[model samples]
Target: MVWGRKKKRGGRKEPVFGGVAASLAELRLNPLDRITVADDKPASRAAPRKAAGPGGDGSRERKPSQNRKGRKGRARKRTRGRLSRLFYWGAVLALWGGIAIVGVVVYVGAHLPPIQSLEIPKRPPTIKIVGADGSVLATRGEMAGSNVSLKDLPPYLPKAFIAIEDRRFYSHYGVDPIGILRAAVTNVLHMGVSQGGSTLTQQLAKNLFLTQERTLERKLQEVELALWLERKHTKAQILELYLNRVYFGSGAYGVEAAAQKYFGKPAKDVTLAEAAMLAGLVKSPSRLAPNRNPEGAEARAKVVLAAMADAHFITEQQARAATTRPSYAVKPVGAGTINYVADWVGEVLDDLVGQVDQNIVVETTIDPKLQSVAEAALIDELAAKSVKFNVSQGALVAMTPDGAIRAMVGGRNYGDSQFNRAVMAKRQPGSAFKPFVYLTAIEAGLTPETIRQDAPLDIKGWRPENYGHEYFGAVTLTQALAMSLNTVAVRLGLEVGPVNVVRTAHRLGITSKLEPNASIALGTSEVSPLELVGAYAPFANGGYAANPHIVDRIRTVDGNKLLYARAQAAPGRVIDPRSVAMMNTMMEQTLISGTARKAGIPGWTAAGKTGTSQDFRDAWFVGYTAKLVTGVWLGNDDNSPTRKATGGGLPVEVWTRFMRTAHEGMQPEPIPGTQRGGPLPDIAQLGRQVIAPAPAAPASVGGPPQPVRANVRPEAASGLDGWLVDRLFGGR
Candidate 1:
């Protein structure tokens, strides 16, 4: 319209700028520019007229508005179709997913026990053995400590676990959806399941009601049980239960037990760093146990502290302090083979406390200090000398003269083996059996002065020979016993009958079966170290038979009700006073100049016998003082012979080490019915004289005696002189 001035005559001519304004408005810079100029003709007609060529025809111009409407209609139809298809497939997939989830839940739930009937099972009974001085020796069975509450634990303790195990524990209902989602994303990124999303409640539910099987079914059941637990108990109670029921390593099954096992303290007393170390054990108890893997445990504890800081439960400074502060666990006082004493106590629990169905405490005769010494001495000896002697294992058993076992070491390493070589293994005692043989002969009217032919002897086709195969012709019985002469023992066994020797051993406390053959004199019969030590007690305890008891008292842990207390009474006399004296005299000589001379305990009068089985399969030193009876055995478990490991070697060394420690502060006592003095009696000189006729009453010292034999040598010493000399310096 501006190109040719609009027919302006009477109608005021449209301003030329009017068209410019319209054009400016129509030059749409954005969608909001919809201004138009007024005209008499229709706007469509005006547009055609403006775009028409000089011929005044508008056919050549294109109309974009109509075409835009049709194209938009087609696009609307396609979008609607796409939305319909997407909705249909989404609904189909959702249905299948729901069905699959329901099927899994049902299948897993069906395999579980009835929910109504489920209950937490009772833990195995724990036998707590205490030492004679009231210190804890060891624990047997499940080492379940006293129950601990999460509230009582240090605040940082529970927080540490929460941060590392389930950070959203308080906010989550039962199972954490956010945690599971995050774990899923992390696992996807790692291409494996490296993190666990189980909540504390979930772990508790599994430990209480389910087996630890890594199956989808078990996981589903765990979720269901977690929900049930949440409904049944508060979060505090659930956490307490979890802490009290979770297992740590080293036979410990509770937070308290783990605390004691690792830090040697109770959970309530655990330090912040200690608590972190214990809390880190949840992932892999055995692998991360502080006592077992301190480095791994420390590494894990640092992770926990870092997590705690991230959760705002601990400050960055606190985390740094904890990380730098090394965490160490003080090993329990008697943790190793000292457990052998605990094992023995558990075995006898049923007899000591009838129907041991609940937690009970057993007061054992073990002296914790002595037990430690014995274990150290035995373990150290074996480690140092066992290889050299071709010995693989050893055992030690020590007891009071009254049969109260003070210490017992069953093996070199309890973790390597728990076979209880001290109380269970039945190995030959070797020449240690000669004591009973001599005792029997003494009872059968023989004296230490009796002359025994040490030459070769054959009994029932068994030709017993001396250790060196060298026989000293006409040796006194004391010399024969001191030398551990196998031939002399065989002769005496044949003279007294093997049956009587067996009777003597049984009367003294040998419970194992004994063979009555002539070989029995050489300890062909197998017996445990416990029984052998016990049987030797009569010589040390003034002829009293030791029962070899361990448990002194038993009582309920909670109620303090007495289950059993050892009845105090005089020990039964197993032998005559004269026989005990004779046995002591003969055995004492062993410590002075015999095979067991290496086993002497300085400043104390001690007596014992050394035994080396045929082929060196077993080496033993059963020695004792007036205060203690100790037996040591060194050998191979498979009964393979050692490299000439005679009883005078490793076994004696171990016995000496242990006995020296055991009698550290004890007062010395002379051998019963004997005196320490100058020289030993010349028994060989007395052999030249015949015995005088015996008086019916006790013979007076320094008195002339009647002669029973016709040929009496004038040069021979009198019986009183011989007796005095023999008693004064017998051992030397």
Candidate 2:
């Protein structure tokens, strides 16, 4: 069909198509050329019959020796036009690198914080005290034992934390990309970051909404909140909200408080070698805490039991019998000073249910085996006699004669002083405050066998010496309060009126203020061993007034909701079942034969009062036992002075080794009203000394006994009818 005719011949003009006159090599050849009719010699001299070749039989004719293979076939078409412009700019830089990675995941998810109001953050409340027989003694806050479920644990403990934290955790969608290219080729062959592509749903989306700060916009808001917690939870509810919420060191926090703090059990009784040492404390939970690096938590629980036998979820003989028997966790029974009853239940937990937000359950009358025998009787008697009684510290409380505390240690190492020294150390309860100056002289009539003059004494000039300033002359106010005499407790605290011995020590529960000054009848007033064991629990519960409490109720850790309970106050009679049987027969003769016969409690007819203050500094004993009154104090948080240590020595040998382990199996009771004993047969006759009618110059419409000036001796201004006419007509 080629008929090109614009023929100029030699002037180089012979090509014409439909008007045919072609000759410039027949219009540069092949349009599938078979136009053999080119005999137009005169018109355009037909000489182009040899262009069609490949066997169309016009056979290879025109050849100026094939012009070097036509310049090497145009140099292979300019190398295929530079490989099609390098695949069109490599597909426009891979579509702008996938739109700059979706504009860096929408500018790190628009700086996060609003995935439909991302919830999951609550968790810090936890109170849980429990111990009046319901066990779990202490746990205050920051989660130590609750929220458990991934189907209540033990499917090899969340498959041993997804075989060392997410073996493609149920085939990842919460950002795994082949586990971040196998943890970036295993941290570039262990050059550093020792491997952690963060996929337990991106560590529960950076512990429930980011702050561990590594950055890159917190790893792109932890992969967009781990793909919005994998589209709002389910791979077993995000592996049970990432095994309850990860962190497992001592301050615990989930997986049932690190399986009840590393296997004191729960999480369905954890075993497989304590679930590979609590899934090897999810890597660095306080540096692999099996109670602080038990050999780096048994070498990270043998690398989580070889990643739970390489994720077959255990069995290379159960990961070599789970690292050949690895179960570590044992520290909970009164975990040292029961955190001093968890720091007095977090300082009375905002005054008994005022602000403690959520989780509660307090219930406390603490007898966790008498709080581990009052913290091993005050840390084994201050570690065997605290530098031989220079006594660094000590405290004990035990209660229940109506006060109900039942064991508190408070020091001698509540981890070297949480300073509760039995409810914050007021000290100087020396001469353990002569039982409220013999219970205000047996309610002002006087009877622990009357007789007083332990000879030498002084009032305004201060010579109250007795610990060997030697005097027992006519002693019988129960041997002058069993030889703690101090001038017969400054003459019965000046005949029952140092403001009636500070109102019988604040109606028998000494709420710490008591300084009615006859040197507070020798206790020199500084109270607190919980108000001297609730003012000696009314001489062991018979005339009641012990209000020393320690959370006896506070409810809601699912016991529905009570908030508080201890209000059953039947403790009315502050002292008078005959002055609580004559002050428990004069402090049971100072624990039978005075100065607390080393705080005796063999079969429990206990009665205490040792004390020792001023210059021998503070030391106390304060016993009780018509079912526990216990007090115990000791010395030195800089109130110094202890080497002569006495409250009859080491607080009566730590109240006779904590009332002989709190009267083991309890059944000896009698010191309450001692069956009409020691008080009225002229004060129970034992070495009879009834001289006490010495008082009376006390009455004045407001002005009298304030005139004592003798420095260290005699101030006997006899007025009660001249001391009952010299003790019933001179028998003295």
In model 1, state the lDDT of residue 54. 38
Model 1, residue 375: displacement in angstroms? 3.3
- Predicted candidate 2 versus true structure: per-residue lDDT over 455-556, tens digit per residue: 554454556556654443555677667667676677777766798888878887777777676678887778788877887787778886778888878887
Which candidate number would show the highest lDDT if scored against the true structure?
Answer: 1
TM per candidate comes to: 0.73, 0.34
Q: How close is candidate 1 to the true structure, as a TM-score?
A: 0.73
Q: What is the C-alpha RMSD of each candidate to the true structure, in Å?
A: 16.9, 23.2
Number of backbone collisions per candidate, in order?
5, 13
lDDT, candidate 1, at 409: 93
* Deviation (Å) of 473 in candidate 1: 2.1
Give Cα-based local distance difference scores for all models: 0.80, 0.73
